[model samples]
Target: MHGYAHDKDNYAKRLRRIEGQVRGLARMIEEDKYCIDVLTQVSATTKALQAVALGLLDEHLKHCVSEALAEGGEQAEDKIREASDAIARLVKS
Candidate 1:
């Protein structure tokens, strides 16, 4: 099973909420809402998405990476490299 399998429902709910927030943003633009207010909402949405990403990464390291390590050999090395790449992408974002 995937590392996030346990919290899959919560993740879907959060993503749905974020989707609503994005749609709200589009509506705000259409309504010509105050610039600062719209920007603030955008920042909030970004942070929410980041929070989800970080949570997934933490779970991955704790579950997936740990399992791979226990198995040993090439699988362990591949998991490490994959996790490293994920972290790099997150940092760059």
Candidate 2:
């Protein structure tokens, strides 16, 4: 398993909630709910996914990046670069 496997349960729970949120959005559309209400839920679900992603990124920095840095070599630089790129993509999204 990857490093984040330890967080599987929590991640799964969050994802399930997001899934439910999406289904709720679909239901709202089917029932002709207010556009604003549906958009509000969409925003909430986006933020929820962002929170989970940030948590995973934090753990990677704390554990994986820290370990790489402690080794004091090229790998450390590479890991830092990789993490930076990943964060940049997340931010852009």
Most accurate candidate by lDDT: 1
TM-scores for candidates 1 onward, in order: 0.96, 0.87
Give the poorly placed runs of model 2, Cα more than 4 Å off: none
Tell how far residue 57 is off in model 2, in angstroms. Answer: 0.5
Clashes of 2: 0
- Relative to the true structure, candidate 2 reaches a TM of 0.87
Colliding pairs, model 2: none
**Residue-level lDDT for 41 in candidate 2:** 91
lDDT of 1 by residue, 42-87 (tens): 9999999999999999999999999999999999999999999999
* Model 1, position 9: C-alpha lDDT score: 98
**lDDT tens per residue, model 2, 3-93:** 5788889999999999999999999999999999989998998999999899889988988899899997999999999999999999998
lDDT of model number 2? 0.91
